[model samples]
Target: MIRGIRGASTIAYDNPELVMQETKNLMERIIRDNEVLPENVASVIISTTADIVSAFPAKAVRSLPKWEYVPVMCTHEMNVPNGLPLCIRVLVHVNTTVPQNEIKHIYLNEAVKLRPDLTK
Candidate 1:
């Protein structure tokens, strides 16, 4: 079966460095929490709020040796009124035997407010 692991994080600044670091942090947590292996990942989709134009968040994962072959895409999130700022969200699609209800979703920093129910 295929499953999706969701995660989001806020960037402290609008620079490429912060975007890359925060994206990496979110991805790492998602992988750990969900027990995901990059080899099993089907694809990774990442999005950032419109205000973030420093870099493609996918660039952060591209540095991972196992993720080199994983298809990754990055886009801009819709500009909604009062939407979270400097936020990067990721949806990782993976081939796994894990049940839907067991899947773990991660939200860090200010992004935690987006899904209080999922927060640990």
Candidate 2:
């Protein structure tokens, strides 16, 4: 069966380097926490808050080892009043036998507040 794992992270500034690093960090956590292998990943959808325009998070993802062929897309998050700033979110679809309730989700930095119940 296919399952979706969610994750989010925040960057301190709009610097391109930071955006790339933070995005990589979030993806790594999501992959590790969920024990997801790249070959099993169906696709990854990434979104950044309006304030994050320095770079596409997918660029960072593509640079990772074994991630060159994983289908990935990036978009801008919907602007909402009082929404978290510099936040990047991702939904990763993967083929796995694990039950949906057992899948792990990752939320780092200030983005943890976005899903208080899921963050540990």
Candidate 3:
């Protein structure tokens, strides 16, 4: 079965390294929490708000050994007025044996404010 997992995080600055580290941390938690294997991940799509264009968050994620084989794509988030700034979001589509309701979604850092109910 194909299941979708979602995660979001915010960067402290436009620095590529910081964005990479936070994105890595967020993705690691999502994959680990859901017990998702790299091979099982069909695709991972990431988006950053308009204010963040220093680097593609997916590039950092793909650099990780655990995610080297996983397909990744990055894009710009919709430029809605008064939207969250410097945020990165991910949508992961995985071929998994787990049920949809069992999947764990993560929202970290300032992005946690986006969905307070989802964070631990």
In candidate 3, position 15 carries an lDDT of 86
Best by lDDT: 2
lDDT of 3 by residue, 63-92 (tens): 877778898999999999988888999999
Residues 1-120, model 2: lDDT tens digits: 999999999999898999999999999988888888999999999999999998989999999899999999999999999999999999999999999989899999999899999987
- Candidate 3 wrongly placed segments (more than 4 Å): none
Count of clashes, each model: 0, 0, 0
Give the local distance difference test score of model 2.
0.93
Residue ranges of candidate 2 with Cα displaced over 4 Å: none
What 10-residue stretch in candidate 3 is worst by lDDT?
60-69
Q: Candidate 2 or 3, higher TM-score?
A: 2
- C-alpha positional error of residue 85 in candidate 2 after TM-score superposition, expressed in Å: 0.6
Tens-digit lDDT track of model 1 for 28-109 = 8888888889989999999999989979889898886688889999999999999999999999999999998889999999
Clashing pairs in 2: none
lDDT of 1 at 86: 91
Ranked by TM-score, top first: 2, 1, 3
